[model samples]
Target chain A: MNRRALLGTAAAATFSGAMPGLVRAQAPGIKVGFVATLSGAGAALGTQLRDGWLLAVKHLDGKLGGLPAETLVIDDELKPDVAVTKVRAALERDKVNVVAGLVYSNILQAVFRPVTESGTFLISANAGPSTFAGRGCNPLFFTTSYQNDQVHATMGQVAQDEGYKRVFVMVPNYQAGKDAAAGFKSRFKGEVVDEIYVPLTQLDFSTELAKIAAAKPDAIFTFMPGALGVNLVRQYRQAGLASTPFLSSFTVDESTLPAQGEAALGFYTAANWAPDFPNEVSRRFVRDFEAAYGYVPGTYAAQAYDAAMLVDDGVKQAGGRLADKAALRAAMEKPGFTSVRGNFRMGANHYPVQDFYLCKVAKRPDGKLATETVRKVLSEDTDPYAAECRMR
Target chain B: MSLNLLLVQLLNGAQLGILLFLVAAGLTLVFGVMDFINLAHGVQYMLGAYVAATLGTLLGSFWLGLLLALPVSLLIGLLLEWVVFRHLYRRDHLAQVLATFGVILTVEDAVRAIWGSSPLAVPQPEGFAGGIEIMPGLTYPSFRLAIIAAGLLVALGLWLLVDRTRAGMLVRAGATNAPMVSALGVDIHKLFTLVFGIGAMLAGFAGALAGPVFAVAPGMGDGVLILAFVVIVIGGIGSIRGAFVAAILVGLIDTLGRAMLPDLLRLVMDASSARQTGAALASMLVYIVMAAILFLSPAGLFPVRRG
Candidate 1:
C-alpha cells in the first residue's frame, strides 16, 4: 500500500479504538459494572451479594429487560480507593452503562463523584448513605437498600411498641454508629439509660458485657455488623444475659446467624428485607439461593438481587438502551418490579421507601436458623432526609 | 462506677492483658534475641485460631483442637523460619519488615481462599458456655474466666521456661549479645529456629484460646497484632518480664478507657461531643501510654541488657 493510505488507516483505527462505545454502540447490549467487597473481612456479605446478583442474571438467561446484557463483577476489597479506581476503570475503559454492588456506606460515598461524573447509572445494592438521601442526592444514583439510619429507627420504634421502657444502646464509634443512635432516639418514646460506643473493629466485649449486665436494663440494642456482631452477641449470651431481651439492627442477620449459633436465636432485628418475607419473589429467591449456594441468602443478597431487577426494569423502560440516563432513572424511580421486599417504591431521593420488618431469629422445623418476620415496624417508610433531596 | 463494676472491669482488663501477653511473648522474643522484625507473627496467631477451629470441628471436641493446635502452630512457624524468616534475619530491619509484610499478605489471602472470609464460631468447650458469679451481682462468662486462668498458667510456664531453663538462658543471653553468644560456640541458627518455633506455638496457643471469645476469621490477627506490638514496645523489646507488666497495663488502660472515658468526658463536655471525643481518645489511649512511657524510658520499661 502507499505510505499516505497506510498512515490514514492507522489514524482511523486509533480514533475508533479510543471511542469504542460511540463507534460500536448498538452491537452489544447494556453493560453493567458491579463493584463490591468480595475478598476481605466481612466478605461473606459481599460474596452473597455477588452470588445473588449473578443468580438473577443467570435466571434471566443472561438477558436483562429483554436485552442482551454484559455484567462485569469486580471486588473492591472493601477499600474506598480501590473502589474509586475500579469504578473509574469500569466507566471509562469498560464503557458500562450501569454500575451497582456497593455494600458499605464509606465505599458508596467515595465512588459517588467518579461514577456520577461519568454519567453512569449507579444503583447501590447494600449501602444507602444518608448523604445521598438528602441534598447531596444525585440524579444518576439510586439505592435498593434502606438508608443507614432507617433500620435502627424502626428497631427503636419496635422497642417502644413492645413496651420496653428503659433501654441501653451500644454501637461501633463512627458516623454510622452515631446515626444509628440518633435514629433510634428519633421515634423511641422510652428513656435511653445509656449509649456506649466502642471501636468498630473491637472483637472482645467482655468488659462491655459486664457493664450491660450490671446496668440491668430492660432491653439491649446494638448495631454491630460482621465479626464484631458475632463476637458481641455470643459474648453477651455467655455473660448469662440470655434472659435479657436483646435487640439489634443489621447486627444479627442471615449473614451472621450461622456463626452466631444459638446466641442469635430469640433476638429481634430490623431490616428492609428477610428471606422469609412471604412474597413470591422473596420465597423463590431464598429457595433458589439456598439450593445454589448451600447457605440462605442474607439481606445483602436480597438487595443486590433487587438491584439487578431494577436495572433490568430500567433497561426495559428505556427501550433496552441504559445509555439513556434520564429514561433509565425515571424507570428506576417508578414502582413496577416484584421486589423480594414487597411494596417497593423509590422515594424522590432515589432511595427505597419500603417497609422495615421486625424479624425474630427462630429455629425452623428442620432445625436450621432462620429469621421469622414478626411484624412490619415501618410502613412505606420514606427517609427523613428525602425532603431535602431536590432530585425532582 | 460502682465498686462491683470497677472490680469486674479490673478483672476484665487482667484477662485481656494476659491474652495480649500470650501473643506478645513470642513476638518480643523473636524481635529481641534475633534482632528480626516478623510482622507475620500476627498471622501465626490467626493460623493458630483457624487450625484450632477446623480441628475442633472435625474432631468434635474443643479439647482436641487445643491439643493438636500447639504442635501444628510450631511446625508452621518452623517451616516459615526455614523458608522465609531465616533469610531476612541477616538483612536490615526495612528488608525484614517488607519481606514479613509480604508474608502477612500471602498468609491472609491463603486463609481467605481456604475459609471464604466469613467469621466462624469456635465452639466453647463443654461446660464453659455459661457465666460464674464471682461476687455479689458480678457475674462474668465462665469461658472468659477459664481464658484468664489458662492465660495465667501459660504466663507462669513461660516465666519458668525463660528464667530457669538452659534453652531460655541461651535465648536471654542471645538477646543481650547475639555475636558474643555465637562466639561462645553456640549454634545461633539452631537457637533462633527453636526460639521462632516456640514463639509461634505460644502465639498459636493464644489464638486457639481466643477462638471461642473472639471471632475466628481472616485478618482477625491484624488488630491484635498491632496491640501485641504495643505490648512488646511498652514492655521492653526483649524483656519477658517487661512484656508481662506492659501487657497488663495496656489491657487495663484500653478496656477502662473505652468503658469510662466517655462518661468522664460527659462531665466536661456535652453528651454527644463527649462520646465522639471519648471514643477517639480511648482508641488512642494505648498509643498515648506507649508514647509517655517511651518519653520517660527510651529503652522499654524492662530492658534485657539491664536484666
Candidate 2:
C-alpha cells in the first residue's frame, strides 16, 4: 500500500481491529489514557485532578496493580468535539488499555461511544452524567465520581430538612444546570419561589441578585462552578444577600475558595468528598497532596486520585492482567480499595455507591478556606437511575 | 415585578451599560480613528484587572492598588502596541483579526503561566463596599452605584477630551478621513499610536474598576470583548456617542430582558414553556435588536457619515 493508504488502513483498523485494545500477552504492559481539560477557564480543576493522578502514580512507584504502566494525559480544552477527537486518537494511535479522567459532563458524554465501543475500559474520574446512570449505561464504562445529580440531590434534601420554606434556585442554562435544578427540586420540600437559569457565561449577577432580593426567599441555592461560581458568591455577598443563607453544590469548592475570599465563609454545600473527611486515607491523601503540591486538593483531585487507586486495585486483583475486559471490570467492582472517600462500591450501573456529605466553608487553622464535612446526608447511597440500569 | 423591583432592574441594566461603555469607548475609538481591529483589546482589560488585583494584595489598599495599577497597565498597553500591534496597522481586517487573535491566545496563556488559572479576588474599595438605602424600604449596593458614577465621569471626560480639545478635533478628523489628516501636515502614525494607547488605558481602567465585581481570571476578557464589539457596531463604528448610546442600550436590553422576560411570558404562557421560551428569547433579544437596527439603518444608529 502507498503511504496514504497505509495510514488509512491503520485508521480503518480502529473500527475493524479484533477486540481493539486487548493487552498483548507478549508485552503485558498497561497503558492508561487520561483526558481532562487542562486549559481555558475551568482549568484549575483539571490541573488538580492531573496532580492527584500523578501523585497516585508516584505512590505506586510507576506501577499500576503491580505491573509497569504508561499514562498519557491530554487536554480536551473543554470542547466536546476536541474531547471526542482526542479520545479517538488515544484509542487508535496510542492504543491504551484503559481511559480515564474527564471533568466535564458534555465532553464525557461526547466521548463515551468511541471509548467504550472499542472495547476499552473507560473509568471516569469526574462527571457522571445521568444518561450513563440509567438504561443507557454501558458495561464497559465505570465512574469513580458520583452521578452528577447526587450532590445536588443531597443539597435538596438538606434544604428540606433545614426547614427553608422558600428557596430561590439559580444555575447556568445548560444540561448540567438542568440536571442540577431537577435534582434539587426532587428533594427540596420548600416552595421554589423562583428558579432562574442564567446564561452559562454570565459573570454579572446584579440583575439576578436584585430579583432574588425582591422575591425575598428564605434561602438561595445556586449551582455555578469555576469563575462563574466565584463571581456569583462574591456578588451575592456584595449585594448584601449574605444574610439569606447561601447554599450550593460543587460551586464553592476549594479550587474557587481563594478567589471567593471572605465571601465564601459560612456558605453551605454538599459533595462526595472533602479534605477534612475523617479517615486515614483521606488525611494522608490531603497531607501528601498539600506537601507535594503546596495546596490542598479539591474534590476533583480527590476523585481523580481515587480513580487511579481504583485502577491500581483492579490491576492487582487481575494479577497484572487487564487483557480480559470482564476480568478487569469485575476486579474494579470489588470493595475495600482504600479510597480517599472510604468504602466505595460500584453500583450495577458502575457509578459509585458512596456517602454524600453536607459541607460548610470554614477557615482552617492556617487561614485558608476549606470544606468541613458537617454531616452525612446519604450513606452508601446509589443513584435513583441505578434501578433502570440493565447491566446489573 | 413590583415597581421597586423594576427600578432595581433598570439600575442594574444601567450599571452594566456603563461598564460596557467603558470598554466599548476604547474599542470604538481605535477602530474608528486608526482603522485597526485589535482583538487583543480584551486582554488589555484582563491585564488591567490582573495588575490591579496583584498590586492590591501587595499594596494593602484597593485605592492605592488602583492608583498604581493605572500607570502600570498603561505602560503595558503601550508596550504591546509598540511590540505587536504597530506592525498590524496596515493589514486588512481579517489579517489584523487573525494576528490579534493569536495575541489573545499568547496573552491569556502568559497570564495563566504568571498567575495560574484560578480566579483572584480584588477587594472592593472602602466606603463603597456595601449597599445603601436609596428610598423607603429599598436599598442598593453602593459599589454598583459608585461604578455608575465613575463610568459616567469617564464618559464625560472622554466627551470633553474628544469634543473640546485640539487633539480631539484631530481624532474626529482622522476618523472621518485619515489620509486627509495626514496630507494636512499631521503625523498620522503618532496620532494612531496615541489613540491606541488611550484606548488601551480606557479598557484597562474599566477592567480595574470591574475587578472587584467580576472574577479576575485568565479568559475573563473574552465575553466583555464580544459585547464591546457589539456596542460599537450597533452604535456606529467611529462615533463615541454611538458607542455610549449602544452600550447602555445593549446593557439595559440584556439585563431587563433576562430579569423580566420569564415573568412576562408567564402571564401569557404556561410556567414551564414560559421559562424556556423566555430564556431563549431573552438571550437573543439584543441580537434581534441589532439586526433590526442594521436593517433599518445600514450605517448604524449614529454612523459617522460626512458629506
Candidate 3:
C-alpha cells in the first residue's frame, strides 16, 4: 500500500472516534454528580441518600424531567479534603450540570463554594448547615433537607410542651452539633441542667451516661449520628437511663434502629419525615425502598428522594435546558413536586420550610424497626437563619 | 464532679482501658517481636465483632458465639499471616503501612458487601443484660463490668504466659533481637507467627466484647485502632505490664477529662464557651499525655531494653 493511503486510513480512524463524541454532545441529557460519604462510619446515611435518589431516578425511568440523565456517584470517604477534590473534578472534568448528595455538614461546607462558583447547581440531599441558610446563602445552592437546626428545634419544643423542668443536652463537637444545641436551647424555656459536647468520633457514651444519671434531669437530649448514635442508644439503655426520657434528633432513626432494636423503642426523635408517614408519596417511597433495599428508609433517604423530584421539576419547568441557569434557578425556587414529607417548600434561604414531627421508634408487624410519626411538632416552620438570608 | 460521678467515671475509664489493652496487647507484641507494622490489626477487631454478632445471632447464644469467635479470629490471624503479612515481613515500615492499609480498605469493603453498611445488633449475654447498682442511685451496665473482669483475667493470663512460660521467654528474646534469636538455634519465625496469632485473637476478643456495647459496623475499629496505637506508645512496646498500666491510666484520663474539664473550665469562662473549649481539649488529652510521657522518657513509659 502507498504511504498516503496508509496515512489517510489512520486519519479516518481518528475522525470516527471523534464522531460519536460530537454526535452525543447534540443529544439532550443532564449529568448529575452525587458526592457522599459512602465508605466510612457515615456510610449507612450516605447509602440511604444514594439509594433514595437512585430509586426516584428509577421511578422516573432513568430520566430527570424530559431529558435522559447520567449520574456520577463519588464517595467522599467522609473527608472534607477528599470531598472538595472529587467535587472539583466533577465540576471541571465530568462537567456535571448538578452537584448533589452530601450527608455531613463539614463536607457540604467544604464543597459548597467550589460547586457554586463553577456555575453548577448544588443540591444537598441531607446536610443543610446554618452557614449556607443565613447570610452566606447562595443563589446556586439549595437543600432538599431541613436546616440543621430545624429538627433539633422541634425536639426542644416538645420538651417545652411536655413541661420538662430541666433537660440535659449532649451533642458531638462540630458545627452541626453546635447548631443542634443552639436549636434546642432556642425553643426550650426550661433550664438546661448540663450541655455535654463529645467528640464526633466518640462511640462510647459511658461517662456521659453516668453524668446524666448523676445529674438526674427530667429529660436527656442528644444529637449523635451514624455509629455514634448506635453506641449511645445501646449504652444509654444498658446504663439504665431508659427511665429518664430520651429526647433526641438523628440518634434513634431507621438507620440506627436496626442495631438499637428494643433499646431504642419508644425513644423520641424529631424529624421532618419518618418511614411511617401517612402521605401517599412517603408510603410509596417507604414501601418501594424496603422492597428494593431490604431495610426501612430513614429521613436521609426521604429528603434525597425529594431532592431528585425537585431537580426533575426544575428541569421540566426550564424546558430541559440545563444551560439556562437563570431559568433553572427560577424554576427550582418554586418547583411543583409533591414531597414525601407531604409539605415541603424552599424558604428564602433555599432550605425547606416544612412540618417537623416528633417520632417514636415502633416495631413493624413484619418485625422490622422504624420511626412512626407521633405528632406534628412544628407546622410550616421556616428556619430562623432564613430571616437573615439576603436572597429574595 | 461529685464522688458518685467520679467513681462511675473511674469504672468507665477502666472499662475503656481494658478494651484498649486487648487491642494494643497484640499490636505491641507484633511490632516488638516481628519488627512489622500491621495497620490491619484493627480489621481483626472489627472481624471479631462481626463474627461474634453473626454467630451469636445464628447460634442463639452470645457465650457460644464468643467462644467460637476466638478460634475463628485466631484462624483469620493465621490465614492473614500466611497470605499477606508473611510476604511483607522483610519489607520496610512504609511498605508495610501501605500494604496493611490496603488490607483495611479491602476488609472494610468486604464487610460492607457482605453485611451491608448498617450497624448489626449484638445481644448482650442474658445474665449480664441489665445495669448493676454501684451506688444507691447511680447504676452501671453489668456487661461493661464483665468486660473489665474478663480483661483483667486475660491480663493475668498474659502476664503468666509472658513472664513464666518458655514460649514467653522466646517471644521476649525475639522482641529484643530477632536476628540473634534466629542464629541461637531457635525458630524465630515460628515465635513471630505465634505472637501474631495471639495478638489477632486478643484484638478479636476485644471486638466481640465491644460488639454488645458498641456499634458493630464497618470501620468500627478505625477509631479504636488509633487509641490502641496510643496505648502501646504510652505503655511501651512489647511490655504487657506497661500496656496494662498505661491503658488504665489513659482511659481514666480520657473519661475524667471529658466529664470534668468543661465544669472546671466553667469556673473560669462562660458555660457555652467552656463546653466547646473543654470538648476540644478533651479530644487532645490522650495525645497530650502521650507527648508529655514521650518527652519525659523518649523510649516510652515502659521501654523494652534493647540488646
Q: After superposing candidate 1 on the true structure, give the runs of residues whose Cα lies further than 4 Å from its correct spot.
A: A1-27, B135-138
Query: TM-scores for all candidates?
Result: 0.93, 0.93, 0.91
Comparison by lDDT, 1 against 3, better one: 3
Give a tens-digit lDDT track for model 3, residues A7-95. 32233223222111111222468888988666656777877887788889878888898788777777787789878887888789988
Tens digits of lDDT, candidate 1, B16-46? 9999999999999899988999899999999
CAPRI-style class, candidate 3 = acceptable
**Regions of candidate 3 where Cα sits further than 4 Å from its true position:** A1-26, A80-95, A318-327, B88-95
Error of 3 at A248 (Å): 1.1
Model 1 lDDT tens row, A97-150: 888998888888899999888777888999988888999999999999988888
Angstrom error at residue A258, model 2 = 1.6
> In DockQ terms, which candidate is top?
3
DockQ of each: 0.43, 0.41, 0.46
- Identify the CAPRI category of the predicted complex in candidate 1: acceptable
C-alpha lDDT score of every prediction, in listed order:
0.84, 0.84, 0.86
lDDT, candidate 2, residue A253? 89
